[model samples]
Target: MADTAAEAEEKFIAEAKTRVSFVRQTGDALSRDTTVTQLVERMITHLRATVDDPDSPVRPQTIDRYENTVAILRGDYAGGKYPTIGDYPLSEVTEDLVHEWLWDVSVIGPSMGAQCRSAMLRAFDLAKDRGVRLWPVNPAKEAKLKRAPRHIARALTVEERERIIGNVTAWQTPRKRTDLLSIVRMLADTGMRPGEALALRWEDVDLTGAKATVTVSGTVVELKGKRADGKGIRRQPFGKSDAAYRTLTLSSEATTRLLERRVSASSYLVFPNDVGGVLSLRNIGTRWRKARGAEFDGVTLYDLRRTVATELDRKYGPAAAAAQLGHTSPAITGRHYIERATVVGDFTDALGTLR
Candidate 1:
């Protein structure tokens, strides 16, 4: 069937090469020593590389959180005394080993354990999708974690809001107290996240008209690495979600506070720290703790935003509140932010008819 001996030889060599390639692939699959850590690292590298892409599935905050979870797995979190299985061979990892790791992390906090479990689940799936076939089954999928208790937010009363605003003992410095008051007021007025309020600049606000408007263009966050200027915390130039970027009408009180601060403002930030940098959330928490003393241990600065959401939901609707809070859906606002009403529609007449 061959045209010549040379042609026949060439066909034979081609078939032989195909068989060799198949054997090599099988051998590699059996002999590969890829570790769980390596797979996670690959996924993390990909995520970090494509995090800025508009089509990237994961958000920037998600990448940061995933990295933090990886730190835990590497025993590098905090003082490196945590649970670790980074060196375990991916093919050898069992469901029991994963369960043990999850339980160990749960000792720190159930919420933290849940977060780690979620990251691991995603990492394993991503790795598998990329043609990494080290594992027969995904160990992360088999792992189980106890459900963490959800924190239900209650709207602060008007009296509580006023007290938080007037608490002078919160900050020893008069300037800090004033800044805290303004920040609290802005959060209460607009239902904006604390980070959004902190990231605000003079350019984001327009007070020329009777009704002042504030643009929600960005948020303050602490990234993994320090920037060229040696600062870890900076404005992220975007909000948590697409809906977060919106323009809101400022209340008269918020407008007044901004105007007063603008007269003496030296920095571009609406709420700069003592060092004129973006006001860190840690500083805000400390001041809030000082102000609350022991009576309001459960109340947080975020509750102010929740309080605004509740008010808006009660006055207008969930849709309106969702818009004010920059939520993509009213369902999220209703389920998480707004407290459930104890009473609803009256069905007494219908019940009586049925009876």
Candidate 2:
């Protein structure tokens, strides 16, 4: 009787182990079969990271923009079918869906569509990286944009730059507007973004140095328009690439101008608002609009950045231009920011000479 009981007990244990093994196999299968919704949720969660910069989290403005792309996929702003692309199966999602979505948003504007497509492509690529098998291929790879979207085409002419400076200088007041004229001039000369220029501390400027240097590290921005995570931070953190941190040597003319325009602000910013808050983009825009008086369509403070890019590209080629602009790759400066080939003289003369 004892031997029979032991044999029964051993058999029962073996059966239980078999059942556990089967359950484990089932779980492995289930894990591999993650749904499309699960994959995208993973993608979204993963993207909420500091990919933009190493110093801090992704800039809030950028997060909002990324979220907007998700919204675009969901048929939010820039209308498309409800229960949109996100509702579909992962393997089932085709290039056609991406192309269609791009086309759908194009009705709103090419720029909006381009931004949406670009964002979606990034997410999809991320999903593939996470072992999701989210797509056999990135559909966006084949989806060609029919026409290039209109971008900022022209740099500010010297006369236009002078006029903007003159206007800003004439329109300033103790409270209404302050120090914007000097900031504009600095941007043109040094290729600093307005935000970078505004965030500059007096200590960061070395007027005493033989080559006047402005450290291009910090950026100032109002928090209201950006993502929640970006709020409460006084200065927008620098984005990825160590190249963003560098010393920019100012021209003799720029150095002289900076010294003349420098002020002792309580905020210690080289350029500050009347009350010494970082000069906001909103304030700058309001003042520029009023100063220009006419429809100076397409002219903005950022154009000054482009103006500097054009000058650098002209003087030193794209690689040197990229270095001055603090880009790790010259391709970015050459492709996006720097203006291509100046039309110096009549091509007809060159052609005749060649003949």
Candidate 3:
């Protein structure tokens, strides 16, 4: 009886081990079967739900950039859709395939390709960290991409600035409006973003003190689904960054312009559309393009801000420019806005000693 009981016990233990092994194999298979598409969707959901900076909510531009990245990955960018490797199971995606795809996508735009690669890198890492390591290695970890081209800011010369101002003024003459001219002058004088300048309300400006000042409180942004056509635009009641919320002492010229506009202002906004509603940034850009035409090729409204930064950096220093531009770091102002050592101190005297 004792021998029979021992034999039965041993058989039961063997069966239990077999069941555990089967369960583990099933789990591994399930994890391996999770497709790239599935992971990307989950990753995007997480991005939409969470905020990295508690002080600042994610901006619409950030969401738009992610959407663009996904569009490229799914082969839905530009127009027609094509079957891509995004549908493949995580375990089946090879590093070489990712490398080649990244290189090919760079043809669209180096920055776009970089953004796509960044998203993929995060997706794969998130999966590997949280779920099972479906693959022995993260495929995106080793994938290489072409370096993006460096874009140096072009600061407008005084002559160019005058010509542009004249061009825009003449362009608006037929329309019998000075809205674009006001905005151009404001942008040139204050170094504020076009969106920030457009979002200004009468209450945000204080012209009563010894020095006039404008509060940088909010900015105009495009929204995805608040209109009948599934697109909306409105002012987000916060600046793009913490540094963006500043009280800027307006220049005398800017203050004078505002005083005049305030007297004739029809709406609460410092700048508004014909319908007394928030102006669409896209429309403003279109109008700007039409007004400037070939006469101001490659010159953009944002360049006016850059011109301010360059002039401020030259006159004072990078810190002043950063403060004016609402940048948190002087490094940012120096790197992107100020021209790179275009006017260095006369080093000839120092080098003369070597001679």
Candidate 4:
């Protein structure tokens, strides 16, 4: 009887061990299902949802920057290309991991690198708040390298501006020529960013008052990848830069040109493509290049805005210019409008009172 009892006890112990092994195997399978890619996707969705919540301190733009960084990581992973982080687990993310990631590979430019670093830092911060024990430190803070200086605003010179305008008129297609000219003139006159100008609809224009306002509250920005609901385009709204959202007055010529362009209106856009869709920045650059025959050295569509700001400063004082240009303060106006000694010298002479 004793021998039989001992044998029974041994068999029971063996069965318990088998059950424990099976449980561990099931847990391992579950863990395998939650990949780094899956974790990142969930984290991004969660972050975006929380961005506008009153409890969240992060701004919308801040969230965008983070989303863009994760997108880059996702691309690298899917393409079998390695970012600085390689195939490390997201749960093991740390400042040291980020540091290695930034300097590890040479796929990104300096500006992009800095942007990615900023985005990652925000993501880690969000993760910490969400009770994720992943990152012990903010890698961006620990990074020793200084990012490149902010791009200097390049405004067209008076001569260059005239050349660009002249070239716009020389286009073979009258409608195309008119559209390009109108866009250039409006930007130069009003100091509005290209995106802001493109976002304008006919309803936004107040020709009767000779003024227009850019309602940055819900301005659309185009994005790539799968559409929301797998249908149509994806666009997002402008963030909380007060200067980015403001009213602008039109020059008499600009108002007249807009009025003239309205005759062919098939759409609400003040500057629409031939198909009557929103004018794209890429198309603008292409047309501008074709019109000028020669690209303006170091100038972009944004330079038109800078040119307007500089012109405003020359016509009025710096403070007045700042207000007209929708700058946050006079200091910003002075910093951007005050060009090199040679450029400022010409403006000074032009604005100088006859003594």
TM-score winner between 1 and 2, please give it.
Answer: 1
Candidate 3 residue 343 C-alpha distance from true site, Å: 7.7
TM-score of 3: 0.79
What tens-digit string does per-residue lDDT give for candidate 2 at 178-253? 6666777788788776777777888788988778998877787554333465553256546235786778998999
lDDT of 1 by residue, 258-331 (tens): 89989999888998986678887877878777776576787888888889889999999999999999999998
* Candidate 2: C-alpha lDDT: 0.66
TM value for model 2: 0.71
- Candidate 1 lDDT for residue 118: 74
User: What would the per-residue lDDT of candidate 3 be over residues 1-355, giving only the tens digit for each residue?
Assistant: 2379889899777756754553353333225777776666656655555534554345655665667666655768777332257677877878888878877776556776777777788778767655447667877777776776766988989999988888888788756443788888889989999999989999999999998999989899887666664348887778878898888899898899899989988898999987677888888888788777577887888899999999999899999999998999999888888876567778898899996
Task: Give each model a TM-score.
Answer: 0.79, 0.71, 0.79, 0.70
Q: In angstroms, what RMSD does candidate 1 have relative to the true structure?
A: 7.3
For residue 25, model 2's alpha carbon misses the true position, in angstroms, by 25
Q: Which of candidates 3 and 4 reaches a greater lDDT?
A: 3
Off by over 4 Å in 3: 1-30, 50-57, 79-84, 94-96, 135-144, 174-178, 228-231, 341-355
Worst 10 residues of 3 by lDDT: 21-30
Query: Where's the lowest-lDDT run of ten residues in candidate 1?
Result: 23-32
